[model samples]
Target: MDTSEIIGQSIALENVFRILAKVAPTDTTVLVTGESGTGKELLVRALHKNSPRASKPFVPINCGAIPKELLESELFGHEKGAFTHAIRSRAGRFELADGGTVFLDEIGEMDFSLQVKILRFLQEKEFERIGGSRPHKVDVRVIAATNRDLEKEVDKGNFREDLYYRLNVIPIVLPPLRTRGDDVFLLADYFLKKFCDKCMIKNLKISSKARELMRTYSWPGNVRELENFMERMAILCENQEIMPEDLPDKILSAGGVEQDKMPVMPARFEWPRLRDMDDRKMNLKDFLDKIEEQLLLEALHSAGGIKNQAAEILGIKRTTLIEKLKKKQLG
Candidate 1:
């Protein structure tokens, strides 16, 4: 039941872990609610792994994935000749998960009629197969997850109120990635290392500017999107370090990063020498000063005028940034 797989040190994520630690061993019906791609399935798996029935089958089925017409048979398997497709008897998720856990994913999308059946199982721990007369009992724990708002669905008559209560005995609400603060960077680095290892490439590191951009951008797709982006970088990155130019346009635009300001992506390594500086038609002091001023301005703009963050971006102490600002009459 190692939960190290669930990355994040944010207070929001830590609270989830605390609740999970308390409830994992219990048989209480739990409902995990979160936005899509927020790792609801992963949380459910952690719950099942830490539960008393860890050794037994941990069955999972996407209630929304199966067609509405066949969802019943998928949950509580059909008897032979139950329908045109039911030529042979088969066990359903509940039966297969006996003595373990049944993860009903996207349970909010379940048909109203099917929900009644699920509610019956939660209440009596018994269910009847499609076209079967006998009621079969199962010793299984139910854990349901959904990205939809079940409360609203219940009010709108889309989901049954009683079933919602039954499934929501213990609610675990997962926070979206945008609100997780520095956890974003932690996950970014983690995913970068992970994809690098998978691709058999030396691990790539995110540049300071790139890290700032990532921290600011709203990750609508959450960890799943970040993971995919990291894998893409691992496979496509031309350099060992990921810079602002290497990021996708979506990310740059989302972070309010100016694409023209980013360093150009070069196919090979190049260095700016004294001879290269000759084109600028300036002395070393003035040239260096201009470069320093531009960097300061970019850092301040990136940090949104937050002195501490701007200093960090510039790799200087806050006092140093302040002194420079005053010296340059730009404070």
Candidate 2:
């Protein structure tokens, strides 16, 4: 699988990748648990792509989305006369996924009776088509995912205990985005670039203050929410740079910064300190030079690359600006 699709460098995300690498090769039943919008389906697809069944069909069905009466026919194939709506013989997900995998999304929402059939299939690797006289055997892997906590469901008698154990032979719990530090900015930047490119707009940059607000805001909808917000910004935001005022009210409130009070532009200067030098592991000369280069770049950017204006912004002579640009090889 192209693991690049799963973006994030946080320790929480790295742990999930480690487990996925070890489990993808095996046919052991996997139960993925996570909140909605945490990219459970994406993770499962990656699993199948990395598995031996990569070339085979990867079938998926939402156990909760389908009617209970028809879910049985959906999972196990049905004969023409299996039910009133079974107008003709049809292959279910299990049959269609022969030699590949069947992803049972929202498995926790499955009815108890259907759970037993799933358990039987997991145990025997065979199942009878609805209203059929004999069993059909198929070599297929099963991967189930749910937003609910199966253990809690089992305790509450809403889910079958035996089926829970069977499907959870290998459990992969995805961490929520809120707990993944700094990953918010990483994803925000990626999504912004992607949406901007798709919309054929100039790439937008998030201000450092706006980034701080995003980092502190709890993204309840996870990566999906971030992607949507970026798309909206790409289409709706007029400014090239996303400042504090550009963010939505929820984000501003969460960051405890009022919209009316928020600055339209970032502060021009913040005095550097000894800690900055220590953080960069640079001595006095190199540290000062790095700071000068950053200011020069910011001035040039603000002036739209006009040398006279950039020199004025930095309060330096045009000749000095040219000399600095030449020395830094930034011209």
Candidate 3:
């Protein structure tokens, strides 16, 4: 189905692709759900492209972006003089999308009253334009995407339950970027190359340390944020390689490398005193174990839970670190 456009090899994404492959050829209505910037619209486009109605027009409407008053006319064309601004009769999105596909983006934001009309269309494949005497039938596939939880909205009396059930015949949920593992680096590299080419500049490579910090930071804005950041770096980065210092402070802080919070060693090393152990009400063995555990945890965190990197930081073999972690029940 040429899902090459949808990037990511994570199991979470692969699962979504599998579902798409099975459902794209059919005329079943699809409901795509995900967090904002999770590529829900992109997925819907892919579905339309791979469907039987690929050659026809693919109409997209953002229900949330349009005003409630004018949205009806936008979806179903108003007749001439139907409203104050209706200069001439025009076809609506559904009519325009006849024999093709209709992508209703942010459908969860649709008005409850309008939702009744939508449900009617979904059931009967027909709708009437504003001030029109007759209903118009369309042969288009319906694909709706939303970041909002429609089921919750239905329970709250915001979304219609019948409409939710009608649209959710085939639900495709996209996973957030933070949970996609190495897909982050894959997408980062893709965006870096894309932006670098656009700017007519050499591609900037991300340093290993910078990549580690990126892996630790939760990307709240998902792919869109990463794409924007990569474009910014492409234009602003003077060096050919992106280092940890090139990343923003938020990422640095999330990775425990914030400048102001970094630890500094004393001028002279002082051995742990008896009073130090007594302060924590611990004996020598227990106090020393506590210190070891702290260092182990710190190493693990710094390495982003990579055993080999943590062992290198502690100057120990990976197997030895594993053994210690297992002994401490920290593995």
Instruction: Assess each prediction's global lDDT (C-alpha) against the native.
Output: 0.85, 0.86, 0.87
Top candidate by lDDT: 3
Question: What TM-score fits each model?
Answer: 0.77, 0.77, 0.78
Off by over 4 Å in 1: 256-331
lDDT by residue (18-89, candidate 2, tens digit) is 989998999999999998888899999999999999999999999999999889988998998888888898
**Candidate 2 at 142: error in angstroms?**
0.6
What are the clashing pairs of model 2?
none
Model 1 C-alpha lDDT per residue in residues 85-158, reported as the tens digit of each score: 89999888889999999999999989888888888898899999998999999999999999999999989999
Output the TM-score of candidate 2. 0.77
- Global CA lDDT of candidate 2, please? 0.86
**How much is the lDDT of residue 328 in candidate 2?**
58
lDDT of 3 by residue, 304-326 (tens): 66778989999999999989866
Better of 1 and 3 by lDDT: 3
C-alpha RMSD in Å of predicted model 1 compared with the true structure: 12.2
